[model samples]
Target: MERRTKQREVIWRTIQQAGRPLGPQEVLKLAQQRLPNLGIATVYRTLKAFLEDRRIVVVEVPGHTPKYELADLKHHHHFVCRKCDRTFDVNDCPRGIKNMAPPGFVVEEHYVALKGICPDCRNHGAGD
Candidate 1:
């Protein structure tokens, strides 16, 4: 059995606790708190390995770098905060988008997003 390194353990545990998809920078920050010597490249590679093994899946954010989340996450889409630039999940698909696609295009995976002000942003009056 391969021995788990401190870096890998920190990276994995940090993201696991987040309970939400996070980008590399975010992962790096979290992991660094536990293992200050952890390098950015190391975190990137660890996430890449997890993705290859299907342990974690990528969170697709339009016009942004991809994020990572545990693969076992429930079927849900993300709600990105336009103001604070955070992301949250939505249990059900957004309203009014049916299973319609281009005539020749095959729909393999669908990602529905509701782009608007989140409660946090609304309370802070930062969403405009």
Candidate 2:
């Protein structure tokens, strides 16, 4: 039991440190640095538990497999730099939480994502 608990902690800390969202395979690489023998199943289960407890949330990438990130931190959306593939915090105005949900569904929060070339990329492109 203690072994499993330690593995879960490592996984959680890995996700927390990732800052941006990460998929299971990515989490496995980080957690393995601490617990090399950690099973992939354990990481998956731990993330699922965290999601169920609202300790983390899902970040869908359209056609890509969804990624997971730590919840309970400051709420902000992600902007993906198309040119550099960097993720940034938009920190846009907060609103439309309740208004975006469907009937009988309550939205306590939301994360808006914008994908485009960031300022750095744009500047680099100008040089090119």
Candidate 3:
């Protein structure tokens, strides 16, 4: 079993409290508020260890740096706001995605990142 440290606990808690996925820099910035000495190296190392131990999962959206979230979260897709560059979880997926693959291809897993203006940005006219 991995021995937990204060830094690891703080890092994990930051991700949990974020409510959505976050990239390494974002994680490091928030974690440092709790443990001021937190370093990028430690953040990366801890994230790597968490992934190896299956404690957390990676969120990948094309053209963006990968984010991380708790492994226990239910399966879901993601949506990216093109205007403000924020990403949000998308709970439901289109039903026929698997069938879109070519014949004879067994689709075991899939990831989708929808891009559009988020409500906040739209209301604020962020990109206008």
Candidate 4:
């Protein structure tokens, strides 16, 4: 069993409080607000341990770095802001997605990611 540390608790809380998946850098920045001396290496280490323990899950979007989120969240998809490269959880899943596959293909699993300018970017004209 891995020993719990202040750094690990802060990092875990940061990810848990965030409504969406966050990358290592994002986790570091947010965690540092409470733990001013927190480092990226510690964030990475804690994340690794969390993953190994199944306390967290990795979120991978094509062309983007992997992010992490709590493992117990309900089933959902993701939305990536093209302009800012931010990711957010899309809580609702489209119905009949598995039926889109060909007749002979078995849809054992699926992932859906929508890429577009988020409200912040769109309002700021970043997409323009």
Candidate 5:
């Protein structure tokens, strides 16, 4: 287990309070609000240790950098706002998605990513 530090605690809390996955830069920016002198290198290093400890999981969206979220969240998927390029957690999963696979094919696992303008972007008239 990695020793707990203030920096690591801030980083973890940043992600936890976000209620959604956050990229390294996002984590650094949010965490810096509380720990003004926090450095990007420390954010990256802490994120690495969190991953090694299985305290977090990576959320990968096509053509975008990976983001991190807590590992203990219940099964879920993601949604990307095309206008703002922000990602949000989609807690509900469609039933029988595996049935979409061709006959005789095994569907061991899957990831669903819905893309559209989020409410904030849509309200701001950023995307149609």
Candidate 6:
């Protein structure tokens, strides 16, 4: 049982509106526009509470910092732009991914992240 504070609300709403996973710094930066007094400590603490309550889930891309997004979002994958270092949500997933696993291995869960030049970066001539 946790009381929802203005900071928490702002943080949650910021993440919800971002439409993609955000790191702690991104959340704090966006939340501060609404609450100038928002602190990094408060952002981290509230994120912890949110995780404990299952209000948010973590998005992990190998070799990158973890990100956070709303828990109720539908299943999806992610793509990272190597040029801009930005991550984007990829709604489409390949079928029969579970069959790729080795024998005797029960595939319970999976996360897919593709790395390439995103459209924005490609448009900017940052990548091929």
The digit string of per-residue lDDT tens for model 3 on 1-128 reads 24348888899899999988888998998988988888999999999999999989998777767889889998898888777566789899889999999999999998788988889988998447
Q: Write the residue-wise lDDT of candidate 6 on 1-128 in tens digits.
A: 24347778889899889988888998998998998877899999999999999999988888777889889999899987777666789999889999999999999888889888888787787334
> RMSD in angstroms, all models?
3.5, 5.1, 3.1, 2.6, 2.9, 3.2
TM-score of each: 0.76, 0.67, 0.80, 0.90, 0.88, 0.84
Worst 10 residues of 1 by lDDT: 93-102
User: Which sequence of candidate numbers ranks them by TM-score, best first?
Assistant: 4, 5, 6, 3, 1, 2
Question: Candidate 6, after superposition: displacement of residue 5 in Å?
Answer: 0.7
Clashing pairs in 5: none
For candidate 3, give the lDDT: 0.87
Put down candidate 5 lDDT per residue, 13-93, tens digits, no spaces. 999999889989999999999889888889999999999999999998887768999999999999987776779999899
Please give the distance, in angstroms, between residue 106's alpha carbon in candidate 1 and its true position after superposition. 8.5
Cα lDDT computed for each candidate against the true fold? 0.79, 0.79, 0.87, 0.88, 0.89, 0.86
lDDT of 4 by residue, 44-110 (tens): 8999999999999998888888989999998899998878778999988889999999899989888
Better of 3 and 4 by TM-score: 4
Compute the lDDT for candidate 1: 0.79
Off by over 4 Å in 4: 1-4, 126-128
Better candidate number, 2 or 6, judged by TM-score? 6
Off by over 4 Å in 2: 80-88, 92-111, 116-128
CA deviation > 4 Å runs, candidate 5: 1-4, 125-128
